[model samples]
Target: MTRLRIVLADDHPLVLMGMRDLLEKDFSFEVTATLDSPTALVEHLRRHPAHVIITDYSMPGDETYGDGIRLVKYLRRHFPVPRVVVLTMVSNPMIISALYDAGVSAVVLKRHNLNEISAALHTLQAGRRYYPPGFQRDGAIDARNKFIGERINSLSPKEYEVLRHFVRGESMMQVAESLKRSIKTVSGQKISAMRKLNVQTDQELVAFCVTSGIFP
Candidate 1:
């Protein structure tokens, strides 16, 4: 029997090492590459084919393939063959939903038992989607989170980009410059995003972004 080829990526060295060791102990898995950044993962995937990829949801350093949904989308767009499983600590239902929409095969919360990783892989092999325990419970999603998630998904791409930049600590002027839009235009986009998110102040916006794990 052929061992499953896998690539593991995480910004934290310890987490990356532990995951590699844990998966390698299982006779069925062969970890082909362990990468620390989105760039390295993409570079490695370009030259080598893997059966599966397990990567962190938030790896903050790479500017080209920013983390979270964007990174997931990039991976799906460039390498559609490999099954992508995201490892994240985020519990936000909205963000998790977005990840699925971005084409992730599964999401394994960091706080869950490491064994879930193996289970996720097996579930995928069986031609089914894997969700963490309680993912389907009605009580798992609150009214407020559902509302916020719906509203968040409604933001236009430009508005979403403005809010993302703001959450990353960029000033309106800087965001405007980076996006090549005028300050007034950028400010309008920010306000529109805030309204859509139901945030009344910049602090509130930042707090929502942090708590919701949307910009992570």
Candidate 2:
């Protein structure tokens, strides 16, 4: 059997290390690298592309940046053969939908039953898409609705627009330019949106949206 070469990336040290150990212990996989940042991981992909990329959806310090969605999009856009699987604790529809659209092979929540992730990897190896064993069972229709509803109930249109750009790791100036609105307009929208979203800081807003799956 040709061993499937892989790389694991997550901002959390323990989580990153644990995932590497788990994959090595439980499967016929060869992990080529484990990285703490997406920037370094991207550079690694440039040098030595792996068969798969197991990435967390969120990064602690990076908040909106150095995250899995953008990283996966970048990998799919530029690299060869490395399929991405999101292995994180976030269980939100916006998150699910965003990662799904980002071209990941799988998006497995960090359920206590992480064995599903192992299964997802094997399924990917066989040229198939994998969702967690009970993603549907676990997150019933109501739970999914709750996430979407939260976004709907919390943010206004302009705030939502700011969030769309913000979640994808865009700068405030970039958001202003892209929306063709003034920085003051963008700044006001952001502040209002943050209040509605119930977040005090921009970093928290990004994390909330990512966790909620509202931001790309």
Candidate 3:
């Protein structure tokens, strides 16, 4: 089997290590280079071509190539345009839409499990785009802003995790135990998620979850 040549770019050491480990262990990839900053990434890419580039949008870089949209645009314009998989902590719909417009093949939230990364890479390899559910490359302007109002995409990673347990009918205590967090912390995250979803009561929250298909 011909291994797919891949490049990784992230500022966080732990995240970079974790991603490298996950890709090497679970996927058919050959991670030729792992770069800590956009400068290094650009430098490496100038000398070597890769099949895919998995990068974090908010990593350290130069003024021109500094992370987020600028770096993505740089990659799109300069390189041969390898399949770009964006693993980011930013869940803002506007920024994500910009990434799609900038030629990002897949956008995976860092909060999601490695499975999402695999799914994204598969989709990109098959010549398709991968956006989180409820997000479209070009949707209504109001709909884009309202996405945060109705979708979990507005929630922080931790809050999203808490909501996953809450929708599964888990109590705050159970959720805390399962997540190895304090009950108070779990409750706070759940409440925060609810606020982001614009739900003021438990009944409304559960209804939202059910209607959103977050719960079976």
Candidate 4:
């Protein structure tokens, strides 16, 4: 039998090491690479192929391929062969839905046993999407999550950047400077994001971001 080729990427060194050990212990899985950043993963994929790619949702410090939905989209666009599984601590239904929409094959919450990673890979082998337990508990919850997910997805890339900066405690001027946009433009983007998210104040926007796990 052929072993499943796997690539693991995570920002945390300990988490990456743990995942490598867990997957390697399984005789059917082969970890071809363990990367710590989005850039490294992309570079590795350019030269090596894998059957599965399990990665964290947020691996900050890679400006070329910013984390979250952005990184997922990039991987799907550039390397569509490997199945992508997101292993993250983020539990916000809105973000989870967004990740699925971005074309990941599975999402396993880190709070669960790491063994779920193997289960996720098996589900992918069967050509099915895997969701964490209780991810689709009821119609009412799905409806609410769908509504918020739509709102969150409506933000343009620039608008999302504005919110990410704000959540990181950056001032409006700081964000504007960093993005090379005028203060007015940055503020406008912030307002637009707030409107889409139905947040009325800066505090509310930050609170929503934190609770939604958009930055985490």
Q: Which candidate number has the best TM-score?
A: 1
Better of 2 and 4 by lDDT: 4
Kindly report which residue pairs in candidate 2 clash with one another: 94-213, 95-213
Task: Give the Cα lDDT of each candidate.
Answer: 0.83, 0.72, 0.75, 0.84
Error of 2 at 101 (Å): 1.4
- List, residue by residue over 1-216, the lDDT tens digit for candidate 4: 567899999989999999998888889899999999999999999999898899998676676777777788899999999989998876666667878998999999998999999898878877799999888564445777777767776787668767877787778897776566799999999999999999999989988888776765
The candidate scoring highest on lDDT is 4
Error of 3 at 193 (Å): 24
lDDT of 1 by residue, 42-90 (tens): 9999999999999997776576676667778889999999989999876
What is the RMSD, in Å, between candidate 3 and the native fold over all Cα?
12.0
Q: How close to the true structure is residue 130 of candidate 3, measured as C-alpha lDDT?
A: 89
Which 10-residue window of candidate 1 scores lowest in summed lDDT?
132-141
Error of 3 at 12 (Å): 0.5
lDDT of 2 by residue, 1-216 (tens): 567898888877898778888889755798889998877787788889688888887653443334545556677888747788888765555556667777888988776576776888889878899876555443445876765557545555455656677666778897776566798898898888787767898788877777765632
**TM-score between model 2 and native:** 0.68
Give the least accurate 10-residue stretch of model 2, judged by summed lDDT: 60-69
Greater TM-score among 2 and 4 belongs to: 4
At residue 6, what lDDT does model 4 achieve?
A: 94
Q: Scored by Cα lDDT, where does model 4 land? A: 0.84
Instruction: Point out where model 4 deviates above 4 Å.
Output: 138-162, 170-189, 192-200, 207-216
Give the clashing residue pairs of candidate 3, or none. Answer: none
Q: How many angstroms is residue 188 displaced in model 1 relative to the true structure, after the best TM-score fit? A: 5.8
